[model samples]
Target: MMNYKIFIWMLIVPFVINGQNKISGNHSTQNLTCSTCHSCDIPTKENPCIKVCPRESMIRIDQPVTDAPKIFVINKIRETDIYSPVKFSHLAHAEMSGLAGGCRTCHHYNPPGNVIGCSDCHESSRKRTDISKPDLKGAYHQQCMNCHRAWSGSTDCTVCHELKGKEKSQTSVVSNNKKRIHPEIKTPDKISFAAKTKQGKLVTFYHNEHINLFSLECSDCHSNESCIKCHSTNKTASTKTISEKIKHKKCSSCHNTESNCSSCHSNSEAGGFNHKSVTGFDLSKFHSKLDCARCHTSKSGFKGLNNECKTCHGTWTLENFKHKSTGLVLDETHSELDCENCHKELSYSKPVCEDCHDDKSYPNNLPGKRAK
Candidate 1:
């Protein structure tokens, strides 16, 4: 009877201790099981067994750069240390992050509400029992050093921290960084790459055309890009070791990088994308304002589309079709007529008036007045 009572107490004590570690605030209300955040069912303060930051599944809340403070004086770690608190330029980094992954690049475990700081999750004390995760000081260094090392190729202590005796006051540092902002990123219209391929030497990329004409966001092509790609001190030496697969990874999303090498790579510098010249379908007149996805619905490639108005418009007749929008307002006689009466060919470039009257032709004979 004594041994059985001792066994019951052992089970009850663990339950009581585990109950104390219950999540508070909005997280408590969430319908998440223990498995969502913790790997072990019985998580104690000493061994929480918390999973790594689930970036893919986490609900991230992103705010504009204007909403955040310009500079943050990082004095949380070791207040009595020799080095003064690092004055971090938040606005400048935020603006630069917009080109790639944005806030989620650093704030990996963000929830739905306001963006929380690193100290909220990462333990501040280095002497803490949670050996699995990095402390706040380690977390700060990890995030900053990763990018700085890539671009500058050095992680010297002086790069961020000034000596205690030489450093200015925190107030002065804040005042100086208050007005600091990242410079406007100048986009190139076109860039010509000299490739080592046997088929073609020059590969011209219309940089502005992809952004303005194709309506692609910067993140679409530039996701997961390191600072070294653009800001590397030795660009040639840094990129020389990169694999061919990594080089063509961005282009392979939209283009066939395997077989159609000549399409992008040519002996001479290639010109910008021309709808009329390449696809034989002139988009300059009617389809200039449309997005690329509007016509190219296929997930694969943009090859299957033929030059037919009805293929996209889907059987436009007298009732539903508006001829006035096409720059020609049809007359009473032409308005009553079917689309096939005027547009005999699938191309639908010009009206065929010869079908009704042999003497009549488009532009010369009036079907209707040109829309003002």
Candidate 2:
């Protein structure tokens, strides 16, 4: 009989202890649990339930099922924390997402309804290594930065998180709160300017020069992954030194060799060589119009002859070619037409009546032939 009583007492003692462990609403000191924080229904350890929730739904834990009349009840505070509530800028961050949509990326599955907060996963303190909370400072820094580094944005320490014990005063917070807030606006003037260059060099790059003058787009020199992966101030950084990696790759690769220069800047008169080359066309433009084979096919790419058009055309003597019979010479109108337009099957062939009089006017001198 005593043995039976001992077993019963053992079970009764556990129940009593658990009853004491139940959270009391009167004490506001303790943090709210996963179940208490949200207003949505949840399962206890005794009974577990699962359901597929839509992404848009806001499932709260403790929201009352039935509505009741409310009254204004302000309680007097005994002691309160001095720390000012952080004015979170989730909306500001959302505007800067670029490609990735805002808040959903970092604040992952948390509580009863699986809506999340940083504190849900990264607790303040932990006993076991497997279930340890990220220390307060570490938690805030890591969570804010890891996402920024992954996305195509700045992850500078000074950009977002304020250093520990350096929190702003409540008076400052109040002053800031009173000021009218506005929507996030991009730094428009800096669009053409690269913000931070290598070595604190402050290279004032004109993106408009490459984009408008050279007919290039943002993607021409930069890949999506390249922009995000490069120039990071984090441990997982893949590349550093923007000059060696980004700038050199874009500029020097094509501009380095001499052979490539003469494709449009040849010395031959036949190719329209300019004695006053500087005034005629810049070296950059000369490079733009050149054919690849004109340089690459030559034995030494640099030794290719002048590109002047007169050099080649001068060989075909003007005296050797003329309009026969009537002896009419081509005026400015015909002179500017492409050589192949009238030359037909043979490039040097004499212009026939049909060649110049395709409109049934000239040569025949019919009704429409006379100048109006």
How accurate locally, in lDDT, is each candidate?
A: 0.81, 0.42
lDDT of 1 by residue, 262-370 (tens): 8889999888999988888899988898988899888665655878877798767679878888898988988988777788777777778888899988789889889
TM-score of each: 0.79, 0.28
Tens-digit per-residue lDDT, 1-372, candidate 2: 999999999998878667546755532344554344433454444332322223233333332212211211111221214332344444334333323322333443322333444554454544434333454445565666766566536666534434446767656744554442334433222222232424233333444544543445344454323224434546455644454445545544334433333332223222232324624423343345554444445543223345543333455434454433224556656645665665554424344447567665345542122222
Candidate 2 has a TM-score of 0.28
Poorest stretch of ten by lDDT in candidate 1: 53-62
Candidate closest to the true structure, highest TM-score: 1
Error of 2 at 171 (Å): 13
Regions of candidate 2 where Cα sits further than 4 Å from its true position:
1-82, 96-117, 124-137, 142-206, 209-243, 249-372
